[model samples]
Target chain A: SQTIHQWPATLVQPVGSPLSLECTVEGTSNPNLYWYRQAAGRGLQLLFYSVGIGQISSEVPQNLSASRPQDRQFILSSKKLLLSDSGFYLCAWSVWEHFGDTEAFFGQGTRLTVV
Target chain B: SQQGEEDPQALSIQEGENATMNCSYKTSINNLQWYRQNSGRGLVHLILIRSNEREKHSGRLRVTLDTSKKSSSLLITASRAADTASYFCATEGNAGGTSYGKLTFGQGTILTVHP
Candidate 1:
């Protein structure tokens, strides 16, 4: 069975502080990884996605960035966090085939609160 | 920009009643998927329907996709309180850009099933 792990279930950070959120998947390789943010009572926003190692595609211009250092490891980083960056961060992975894409599996998510 | 938009930003229902959520997308797609998210939790993929397929059923859930209309709908029969959560629609576009296998999500519909 495949599973995803995300850390620091809840985080409280000050404005201008650095942030790093990690996500790792077990039991899969070469899976497409994605990072999403959700505001309270709102829909999700796609932030970043990776199809392979060291290859990442960003969906929007934002205060955050993401990297895929390994096949199953994805990291979301912000050199200096802003108050607007506080939200629920989610990590997800999907299998891509020549035919198309499959359903995505998601991690538990990280709740970041910047004051 | 987000590719899919779910309708009826929110819904309220009772157990034993049915709940339906609709979504509309902007571009060509290989497939469309629906997901469920509990409060402050990661999303769980509910179902997927290919562009060529009009309707699909998984247990008590029924999904319909209309490529011509660029829209889809999810129906939950005999709803339960446990089904209370936010539902989102996502589209996997056929477009080839720097971002491959991207699942763009909509604003989501909040479903509240009162016991």
Candidate 2:
């Protein structure tokens, strides 16, 4: 059984503050990791995804960035948060496979309130 | 731009009634997946249907895919109040671009099942 852990579960930070959200997966190695953000009552936006360590792909230009420091450890960071950056951030993982039949598993998201 | 779009942005139904949601996508896909999200929580992967498959079932959930129509539908039978949540559809394109295995999500359908 694989499990993903994300923290802090909720955060309240002032504008322009630095931010760091970590996600780690256990019981799996070399899995694909992704970072996503969802606005209030809106669809999810892909932030970043990594197929392997030290590799990251950005889907859209935004104030946030992601990194894969270890095989199962992914981190989302922001040097300076914007009001628009406030949203629910999520981390997900899937087994790296050919192309199909891969299902992603998500962690309990981090709700960031930038005031 | 979103690759997938879910219809009926919001749905309200009584418990035990069946809930159906449709999703449409623009490009060729390797597979399409349905996910469920409780309020303020991360998504849970519910079902995945490959492009070659027309229908799939898991317990009370049934998924149908139409490659010709470029659309998919998720059916929840005998829905319960616990099924009240947002449902999203994600697509993994078959096109061997750099975005392979990177799922593009649709604006979800908010399902409200009354007890």
Candidate 3:
């Protein structure tokens, strides 16, 4: 059984503070990873996705960036956070190709509040 | 730019009634997927329909896709209070490669199932 983990579960930071959110997957190897953000009562916005280690594609232009340092480790970072960055962040992973039973699985998520 | 847009920004319904959500996309896609998100929680994958397919069912959920109309619909039969959540549609385009994992999301529909 594959499981995804993200942390810290919640964070409160002042404007311009640096931010780092981590996501790791267990029970799978070399899976595609994705980062998404959701505002209250809104739909998800795909921020970034990775096909392989060190390979990332960004969807939106923002102060945030993502990196996949290892096969199952992904990181979301912001050198300087802004008020608009406050939202619920999610991490997801999916198996490559072989779509038989492969579906994206999400982590518990991180609630970031930028004050 | 988002790929799909769900209609009826918000809906409130009594339990036991059926709930239907519609999604329209801007460009041609190879497949479409639906997801559900509880309040402040990560999204959960619901269903996926290929462009060649018209309808699919899982439990009390039924999904229909019409490539000719560039739209899709999700139906939750006999809804319950626990069905209250936001629903989003995602699109997988036909570019870059057949199995490319890039997915674009849309604004979601918020469904409130009152008990």
- Please, what is the TM-score per model? 0.95, 0.96, 0.93
Q: Output the lDDT of residue B50, model 3.
A: 80
The true-versus-predicted C-alpha distance at residue B4 of model 3, in Å, is 1.4
Q: Give per-residue lDDT, candidate 3, residue B75.
A: 97
In model 1, where do residues sit more than 4 Å from their true spots?
B96-99
What TM-score does candidate 3 get on C-alpha atoms? 0.93
lDDT per residue as tens, model 3, A16-42: 999999999999899989998978766
In order, candidate lDDTs are 0.91, 0.92, 0.87
lDDT tens per residue, model 2, B3-60: 7889999999999999999999999988999999999999999999988899999999
The digit string of per-residue lDDT tens for model 1 on B42-101 reads 999999888789999999999999998999999999999999999999988877653365
The DockQ of each candidate is 0.71, 0.72, 0.49
Candidate 3 Cα lDDT to native? 0.87
In Å, residue B61's CA in model 2 sits off its true spot by: 0.9
Please report, as a residue range, the 10-residue window in candidate 1 chain B with the lowest summed lDDT. B94-103
Interface RMSD of the candidates, in order: 1.4, 1.3, 2.6
Q: Lowest summed-lDDT stretch of 10 residues in model 3 chain A?
A: A95-104
Best by lDDT: 2
